[model samples]
Target: MQMIKQKVGARVRELRNQKGLSQEKLALAADIDRTYIASVESGKRNISIVNLEKLIIALDTSFAEFFEGM
Candidate 1:
């Protein structure tokens, strides 16, 4: 679970950066808290499936594409 969290976090951060979005921007777009996004990107938060879906949507991506390399 810890490993999965870290991988997801890393992927989120990577996608966020690739999209040129800030934590605050992504949080607002995803309707999530900014601090939560920070924690998530740092691999310190185990994100819920619902919130994960929101983030993926805000990133303009799908789970299949997002987890492609993983």
Candidate 2:
């Protein structure tokens, strides 16, 4: 589960970077807190499905794309 969290975090960071979005920008777009985004990116939080959906939508990605290789 920890590994999954880390992997998910890494993927989020990767996509965020690829999209040229700062954590603050992503958080703003997702309507989430910047610190929460930071924690998620750092794999320090077990993100809920609701919040994950918010992120995925903000990132302009589908769940299939987000979890493509996981």
**Per-prediction TM-score to the true structure, in the order listed:** 0.95, 0.96
Candidate 1 C-alpha lDDT tens digits along 1-70? 4798899999999999999999999999999999999999888998899999999999999999889978
Backbone clashes in model 2, listed as residue pairs: none
Q: How far off is residue 59 in model 1, in Å? A: 0.3
lDDT of candidate 2 over 1-70, digit per residue (tens): 4887888889899999999999999999999999999999999889998999999999999999999978
Lowest lDDT block of 10, candidate 2: 1-10
TM-score of 1: 0.95
Q: What value of lDDT does candidate 1 attain over all alpha carbons? A: 0.94
Q: What is the lDDT of residue 26 in candidate 1?
A: 98
Number of the top TM-score candidate:
2
lDDT of 1 at 44: 90
Where does candidate 1 stray beyond 4 Å? none
